[model samples]
Target: MERTRNSWKCPIFGDLNDLKDNVLPTYGDVMRFYEWTRHRLKYERERNKEPTYKEIEAIVVARLIEIWAKSSIPTVEPKRMKVMLQTYHLKCKNLLKSNPRIPKNTLEGFRLGSKALFDIAACKCQEFLKCACPKNKKIPARERGFITDQRTARQMVIGALDVVTTTKITKTLKRKSIRENSKSKRLKKPKHVRKS
Candidate 1:
């Protein structure tokens, strides 16, 4: 009799090793994780106050590690996870910086930032899960008719984020458009004929 070797291991759950080959994480798991994190952060804020960036970063990193470990991929390394988290953090920060109308101290700004982070995480998780599985193999959930495609998953994340931050995004876009339109109008006006 030949023994089969399992290549995948859950970093957070040692007991999951036995089932790693048989099971894989689903898109639903990613969504649920985001929802859970958002609610937990909200509750914590209500009880105490706004958590510091370090506190939020710690929570985000821990949750990501747990989620990735639960997936079919083998061994979510700390370095890779931290790099991913840092990239998303920078993206969210840049988004805020670009949208000057959205005051960072306001409740709306905080909510938008949280939503953006969740969106980034969800998109990354979907891409990672889709590509992690071998081409010849069907995802565990896909075989059961869960029917999650990469494009659809990405679009869903983007749409959800858009819905949440539409006002802020649109306002900034409108301002930019108006500025551009005025600049174009000025350029269109022929320079007054300079007669010596």
Candidate 2:
């Protein structure tokens, strides 16, 4: 009995037969890819009890290659993975730096930053995917949740920052009160020395 080789089927590119043979993938393809990966990651976390950093990286790289191969674009090389990942990280870092409301020190800030990083990663991935096939297209309205979620996360981070700032201000005010009370006592007028 001959063993049949199983062809890898990409959730995003498996059914894009209508696309021109030479045409690159559109924004729709990238968005579908992102959603697929997000679901796969969630499933992996639930089933395998959370993958380590290295495991996660391997999964992302593998998925990227699979998507590229399935797209039938001859120009996109596997070597581009490293560059794409680096660009993604750079974009995330720049986003974090540009937004001053996301606190870097608090737990809430860290959570918000992580969300922002994921949001930027999705954006960068889409950008790279679009470049691979060079097409002018707008993301569909139904798939615009990425933008909305990022905006909501930013607002939440701003709210968290306000809370942090208020607490810090209150602490400083308490310290100042103590110091001011001591200074006031020291500056009190000396008892009147009556000339007896």
Candidate 3:
């Protein structure tokens, strides 16, 4: 995520490897541009033109971003999670051990990232925040439950329109550079170092 290939604009992430350690995107984006781009890029790369890239390159890119988003979690509501863990401690009377799926010690770091993301998502789903997600202002309390659910579903859909997209420039570029340096280097170890 850069404004341009290489510009004065600061990049969203400092390093490519940091992507996995960062947030995860949700699943089932109906309008992911990558799905289309995957094929198109493959076609172009075969011709040796850089309009796109495909095949193994495309697979790697997908692995780099969506894999984490789809496979694992990126921290969830943490300030909330802390409040939850603390409440757990109080309720269970186990201050030292509360069986948190995520421990409280890492809460500081989790708070920093999740606060921003949670606020963004929460703000959108709020009673009214002026986001792309529709606002159901002044609905009856009795109907608010379903209305809220509907709004949330709409929010996810609207947010996902052409949303699942990213360029793994850093990784591929680094790989190409490494290839230039040493041809036989495998990025990862084989399934078995020794076969039976």
Summarize candidate 3's per-residue lDDT along 52-119 as a digit string, tens digits.
Answer: 32243344344434532332223224344334333422422232243355366554443333222211
Per-model TM against the reference = 0.32, 0.27, 0.18
lDDT of each: 0.41, 0.41, 0.33
Which is the better candidate, 2 or 3, if ranked by TM-score?
Answer: 2
Task: Provide the lowest-lDDT 10-residue window in model 1.
Answer: 11-20
lDDT of 2 by residue, 58-175 (tens): 5555655544333222223434554555465454446446555644455344333433322222222344435333232333333344334433542311111246755875899899
Q: Return the TM-score for candidate 3, rounded to 2 decimals.
A: 0.18
What lDDT does model 2 reach?
Answer: 0.41
Report how far residue 99 has shifted in candidate 3, in Å.
Answer: 29
Candidate 2 Cα misplacement greater than 4 A, ranges: 1-53, 101-196
lDDT order, best first, reads 1, 2, 3
Q: Kindly report which residue pairs in candidate 2 clash with one another.
A: none
Model 3 bad stretches (over 4 Å) = 1-32, 44-125, 129-196
For candidate 1, write residues 1-196 as lDDT tens digits: 0112222221111111111112233323333333344445656566645446556556655665554334322333555555655665565456446665655456354443333222222223344345554443334442222123322332221111235455775898899999999999999999888899
